[model samples]
Target: MKQEKGAEGFSENYWLENYADVDDMDGMYNARDHAHYLKAVFALDQIAIRSIADFGFGPGHLFSAALDTFKPYRSLGLEPSASAFIKAQTVLKRYQPQLLQTDLASWCRDSSQHKRFDLGICTSVLQYLNDQELAAVIPTLALRVKYLYLTVPTAAEQQRFVEEYQFVDQYAYSRTRQQYRELLSPHFTVVSSRLLESKQFYNDQTSDFTEDLFRF
Candidate 1:
């Protein structure tokens, strides 16, 4: 499906309004989501990981968690939302991760040392991109990092979520598991996948989301 610009299209104003109170936005992803991401990070033990690149590093929680657990030598985060970026900087100040106010594709294109990470993380961000955007970014991510950990709500899962919860967020594009895998196949290999159950904010809505590990 073609990407549609939703009512609030991830613009500066949208983030400013929604994330004005960072405390209120902290519960956007429940504890279950945090556990799932931590589990994914634990799976990286088989491979030696010294550096990490995080895309859409919301609130810097996942990156911070990884740092605390894995203690990678270097970590970098790219966030497009200015409000979230500012919060992440403060939240992750102690960790001292290199943070950038840009998207993944642009960062990869402009940086000479972009392809220097052992792992790449893009959690809860793919659904916001349309097919074309995904096509453009996935390849760059594959080329830049040796491995990628991506988490997104698949089409079927999202359909059930919307129907059961009456929660509608138009900013995201729902795609099937196959569609997501296809987009990444050209540049990476799917190493593993798992379903992560989590709750939405307002209604306590639940869904078994998909998280995939890819080797580039």
Candidate 2:
């Protein structure tokens, strides 16, 4: 939550102020990303999950697919962003209306209150965290969730962040696949992982967004 400049340094507040407003919340960009994540979730044994927790559920748009596809006993979207929280509530009224507005640290600390969710997800959100945050958050989630789904930028993708877009404080580290495995090995088994390469069109050129999904 601290504000600073450089990679791994963007405050949650900065993101909130800058990205709160958007014309289309769910469009081509989001849809493509969502498709990959949804595929990862579908690979799991759906019968094992009674409820789902979208750990970094921004605007809760992605949870819409889970609600429709899994039909869990219940679904909860957690977001620390007040604006995102509010928007998620409004955006997903017909989907999973109940959302828990608390940061990951707080949510994990009070796991007894959220002991029932069988699945936990944090997609496209880890790139903002620094090494410390990721270390603290991952194990906590592994303990609480029987299954976990997450996405993060690859090392190559991290390098492409424009100077102004650099924010590393949010992510304690941007790790390689092997490093990621070493970090998660003590807690849960890695079920599957695959790199997702996507293309985005700029004014007259194409930019690539390389992300990968990890399931534990």
Candidate 3:
């Protein structure tokens, strides 16, 4: 069955067809990767973070691992893929984090929910967004959270994998590291930056990744 694509060209149906099972989601970070993520989460000491949000939280692995490191009063995981959301519900049931099956822009546009988060995490997901979506989502994220942890595949990294990897029915755009910094500089203060290597989150391969900490 063909999967439905969102307005921004993200295909929830495609992900469901390929990775309906939680085990099939290799994008979820491994134990070592989770440790690295936790270290960044705890680095923000300006405020005691009581609430957190995870954009594009596929299969809830990062969120689940986070529960062991820190307990926030409220946690929200926003995922566009319905199948991934379903798997997250079961896998993350113990943490009780609120899971939403919608893209970030739609969630941000809701006038009813004025809730804001202390920290937001977006890992291994930004490369899938096109320019227009990035323009809308980045500002919204800045407005929604005090801080953000964003991870993306750099242009150099994307180039290395272009031959063997591609998203099904989604447009994955790559930008130079400088371009990304310029894109975010107007909306956030860069606090830290680092590079990470990971096994393919969607395919059976490996990739170089970059993570940045930003204060909104």
Top candidate (lDDT): 3
lDDT of 2 by residue, 1-216 (tens): 334422222456655654555454342236446645655544543424567778767756667666655667777777776666776687668764468777676676774764556666677666555577668877777666666666766565556553545533343346677776666666655444532111111111231111223323
**Candidate achieving higher TM-score, 2 or 3:** 3
Winner of 1 and 2 under TM-score: 1
Q: Candidate 2: TM-score?
A: 0.65
Give Cα-based local distance difference scores for all models: 0.63, 0.57, 0.63
Q: List where candidate 2 sits over 4 angstroms from the true fold.
A: 1-48, 163-173, 194-216
Worst lDDT run of 10 residues, candidate 2, spans: 195-204
Tens-digit lDDT track of model 3 for 1-216: 122334343455556544555453444537336535555645543335578788888767777766545688899888887667787788779889888888877777777767888668787777766677788877777777766767787778766655555533234565898988777766666544532111111111221112223322
- How many residue pairs clash in all the candidates, one count each? 0, 18, 2
Stretches > 4 Å off in candidate 1: 1-45, 194-216
TM per candidate comes to 0.72, 0.65, 0.72
Candidate 1 least-lDDT 10 residues: 195-204
Give the per-residue lDDT digits (tens) of candidate 1, residues 106-163: 6766757545676677777788776666778776776677656777888887787679
lDDT comparing candidate 3 with the true structure = 0.63
By descending TM-score, how would the candidates be arranged? 3, 1, 2
